[model samples]
Target: MPLDRRSLLLGSPFLLSGCVTSPATQRPSQAAISRPDMVEADYASIYAAVDGEPFPVPAIDLQEIEPEFLRRAVGYRTAERPGTVVVDPGERYAYLVGEGGRAIRYGIGVGKEEGFNFRGAATIARKAQWPRWTPTPDMIRREPQRYGRYAGGLAGGAGNPLGPRALYLYRDGRDTLYRLHGTVEPWTIGTMVSSGCIRLLNQDIMDLYRRVPVGSRVVVLGSGGGTAV
Candidate 1:
């Protein structure tokens, strides 16, 4: 059978880590409601296709996605400083902390298995545009027919699972093997699907890439209490 998005995301490699199992309760504050000034055309432009890249990123069909999962600014209550990245897996959301209780929020697709999720603080040690992807030894061992052909690694391109950009996460100068990356499967946002990586829409990740830099802090919150790895 040909490899599909489900195969690619579910079989992707990630280092095992602890995560909280409780559900999240916080929603966007009333102050952070959707911008009334933003019309349908605004969303169209926001998810529009781009021209300058190694590969063409097609526009997203908004109708295919729930409006709640679209990118937007929201009122977030957090102690993290501006430029910090906070991921709440239970909520299927990620926040780019900003000044004055505000944050730019993006919908995210997390690991399907709770045990596969990594909860803790990390740093954006590296960033890549259209990064390469390689299945891990364990993944290959378990599913050789699915991952064996790509032992040499898959190149960055439109067909690659990492999509257009990737933010590499690390701790204490060591790679954690977790990533905040883009996905071509836009409809997967706000769901539990990936092996472990925190995935965002290609357009959203590209937008985040422009604003965040290497060395930025990242905090992945636990389901109930905010726990750190």
Candidate 2:
């Protein structure tokens, strides 16, 4: 069968073989060899399909995801206070600052180009569930054939690129147009492939949505620079 978005997202067994190299040619990374603190059953439950929303969210196939990219708690030492969101595009990780030198780290897919990524402090002034997505004017100009048709906007749903939730970023009381949202292409997590927004797995973004609220601070680090943007 041809690989559709859903098929690729679900990590169909037949598709999996072609997605990665054979064990004969390459060895698994240490991160992949060592499992997270959570067991198989725990991961299954954590990433299970979510209901009770405007639309159903399909479960993520862990096999399609990198082990390091899976959501997990880690010791993070940062001056930022709890509830702050620190996005490290260089590492492709978003850290939700927590108390006691710890954080809930979620792997993220970022802008493919450094120039396209947002680098600065902003506030989560608004949020939406299954939010509408409209390509920016620049996006339309750059790729008319790809984005011009959606200039008006695309309604939120399972098929939408902005998957399940979106945390809108604002600076100086104005919308920055940079968002932290979910993606239908869960396999893209941990890679730099988005236009500009940071994308999380549908399940992971929902978890973050429940944890964060409007008015939260968001700091996106400069590409390859540890300095706060």
Candidate number of the best lDDT = 1
Q: Which tens-of-lDDT digit does each residue in 1-229 have in candidate 2?
A: 1113553243312111011100011222234223332223256767877766778788788899999998877877778888899999899999888767777788998776666678889999999998887756654565577556667777778767677889999999988878888887888889867657888988778878877889999999885533321
Clashes of 1: 0
Candidate 1: Cα lDDT at 207: 77
Model 2 off-target regions past 4 Å?
1-41, 142-146, 223-229
Question: lDDT for model 2, on a 0 to 1 scale?
Answer: 0.71
Query: Model 1 segments beyond 4 Å from truth?
Result: 1-41, 224-229
Model 2 collision count = 0
Candidate with the greatest TM-score versus the true structure = 1
TM-score of each: 0.83, 0.79
Residues forming the 10-long window of minimal summed lDDT in candidate 1: 17-26
Q: What TM-score, to 2 decimals, does candidate 2 have? A: 0.79
Candidate 2 C-alpha error for residue 170, in Å: 0.5
